[model samples]
Target: MNASRLTDHTGYWMRMVSNAVSQEFARKVAGQDVTVAEWSFMRALYDLEPVPPSVLAEKMGMTKGAISKLAERLLAKGLVVRTENKDDKRAHSLSLTNEGRDKIPVLAALADENDAEFFDTLTREEHETLNRILKILAERRGLDATPVD
Candidate 1:
């Protein structure tokens, strides 16, 4: 029987580039003492200051349990703080600590560097076109979730 080679698929090619890009970024963030998921969570929380984990979970398209887990990790690292709701003893909200707020730009810079490492080979026009195509694909596919993995 004849078989199609793996490299004949566009997904295979995309994955080859994606895995290398992702692995390098993972290494970059590891040096900053945060996982990619944590970075994503922190970046989300940065925008929704003092928000409940439930809200964060919704915004991130993540489970509440997942949000809680990320919150726990961030809290342990002193990068986030959880505050009890005044009206409800069992309810709480999460927010970035001063240190975490400070780290956002630094982490963002690392993300920029990572993108450059992988995509700088593309001409500026090519890069913009690639971004437009990816965005269109993402929108059409309803792939709206924040990419944590």
Candidate 2:
């Protein structure tokens, strides 16, 4: 019987790099009083406003409960507003407040900085190749969840 070492797997290397990148970005975003999960949630709302939480959950590939928890946090932070759906009194739609809209650019800048800091060492072709490969794998595996963790 033969067993392969962990280092023999490409997945090991990918995970190592991914974990480092995510951890660093987590630390950077923490300074803005938001977790990476919250950042993902807010980013989703940056474009599609006045959407129901169920729609958000589907877009983010997260559970409705998770969206609710994140919504509560953003609501408390004055970053989002929940309004009743006029057509359906039992339903509510969530939208980013002015403060939330203002903070998106700032948070996006942080994301840009984080990516540059992590992947800037690669050449342009290498960067593109890496992204292409990741996208292919994601599509093949049907992994659509935003990397909130």
Candidate 3:
């Protein structure tokens, strides 16, 4: 069977593109001292400020234990802080500290650069079309396209 035949399948193309783009993005972020998972968690925090670890786990599609570990690491790095929620002491809210807040924009800029590096060859129309299609898939799959902070 020819591979081109499978190219018409959305899952096949999505995985191929996602894997390639993410690997290159991981490389770009490596110089900044973060793994892809850390970057993702940070970015999520940026989208939703003062979110609890449980909320973060849901947003990241990660386990609470994993989120707790990452939160601890980020806290140690002074990038994020955890505080008891005034209304519920049992639930702690997380937010980016001055350091965490500052790093997000820089990382976001790097993301833009990475996208340009890979997709700059596409025409504006092509980019728009791709975005539109991808957004539809994201919506259908219930993917949280929103930033986590």
Candidate 4:
């Protein structure tokens, strides 16, 4: 019988690259006192605000409990505000505070910087091909773009 080496798997190599990229980005965003998941959450909300937690959960492919927990942390950080609907006692929505909105661009810059640091090694065509391949994999796998991988 013969067994393949650990590096023989595609997932092994993908994980190697992913861990490096993710860890570096996590460090860069840590300077902002935000985790990568939190950054992803905030970035998603930046595009769709005044949204209910349920809707956000669906859009981010996260559970309601997870969204609630993230929301609580962001709320405690004074980065977001929740507004209760006047006509519905159980209905509420969230939006970013001015500070949170202001930080979006700065956080986004950090994200961009992180990408350049890791991916700039690839030539333009190589980068494009890699991204296209990844996107195709994501689409075929029904993966959301929520950055939770």
Candidate 5:
């Protein structure tokens, strides 16, 4: 194949793999009544005290508006609490509620299962190589290395 054609072919395969992974994880998580994105946000809040939405945005590689929206949904679900920042009168901070905190391990388990289900075909070495490549891509793309909050 020509170089351009090869690039196009690889891109298509990349999207196919990505979509499959994402969809499968979403399906696995449906039982928990949480979307992948919501779970990501909750996982980010795990182990941390109240944090500003801006910090979440930076850590999650999302916009403050998007974080706020996610927080709103989490709040409605009683999974997170948003409160005024003690130090910053105008800014708000968010943290997981007791219920939300308790759900992190469950979601993490689901995530682990999701990975195992999809990537189990790969040998340990292959999985490690894939992880290394993906990490490189994330850095190249300027993506956040921090876990999604």
Candidate 6:
């Protein structure tokens, strides 16, 4: 029986880089009064306004409870609004408030900056290859959940 070293697995390295990238992005967004999870939720609603909570949950690959919690927070922050469904009074829809719409471009800029800060060291070809490989692995593994943490 042979034991493999920690460095023997590509997953270990991937996780290390992923953690660094996510943490820095989290920190950046924190200054903007939002979490990465909130940013994801806002980004999703940026173009698709007035979507149902259930639809958002499905698109984000999150549970309804999770989406509801985030929505509540955003609502309190005046970044999102909820309205009764016109067709179904029993259901409700969510959309970004004017403030949310304004903040999205700033948040998106932070995301772009975070990616550059970490991945700019890689050559263009290396970056493209890495993105391709990661996408393939994610698809193959059926890992569709948005990274909120």
After superposition, the stretches of candidate 3 with alpha carbons farther than 4 Å from their true spots are: 1-10, 86-89, 145-149
Candidate 3 global TM-score: 0.80
Q: How do the residues 7-62 of candidate 4 rate in per-residue lDDT, one tens digit apiece?
A: 99989998999999999999988899888888888888899998999999999989
TM-score per prediction, in order, is: 0.96, 0.96, 0.80, 0.96, 0.86, 0.95
List clashing residue pairs in candidate 3.
44-148, 44-149, 45-149, 46-149, 47-147, 47-148, 47-149, 48-148, 48-149, 49-149
| lDDT value, candidate 3, whole model | 0.84
Q: Could you tell me which residue pairs clash in candidate 4?
A: none
The parts of candidate 4 lying over 4 Å away from their true place are none
Residue pairs of candidate 2 with colliding backbone atoms: none
Top candidate by lDDT = 6
Q: Which stretches of candidate 5 lie over 4 Å from their true place?
A: 1-8, 86-89, 145-149
Candidate 3 lDDT over residue span 3-85, tens digit each? 56787888887788788788898888878887777788999999898998989888878789989988988898888899997
- For 71-118, candidate 5 gives per-residue lDDT tens digits of 999999999998986787898889999999999899899889888988
Query: Over the stretch 68-129, how does candidate 2's per-residue lDDT look in tens digits?
Result: 99999999999999999889899999999999888899889999999999999999999999
User: Which tens-of-lDDT digit does each residue in 11-129 have in candidate 6?
Assistant: 89988999999999999999999999999999998878899999999998999999999999999999999999778899998999999999999999999999999999999999999
RMSD values for the candidates in order, in angstroms, are 1.0, 1.0, 3.5, 1.0, 2.9, 1.1
* Tens-digit lDDT string for candidate 1 (1-149): 99999999988997898889888999999999999999999999999989999999999999999999999999999999999998999999999999999999999999999999899999999999989988999899988789888
Candidate 1 overall Cα lDDT vs. reference? 0.94
Q: Which ten residues in a row have the lowest lDDT in candidate 5?
A: 1-10
Q: In candidate 3, residue 95 scores what lDDT? A: 93
Quick one: RMSD of model 1? Answer: 1.0
In the predicted model 6, the residue pairs found to clash are none
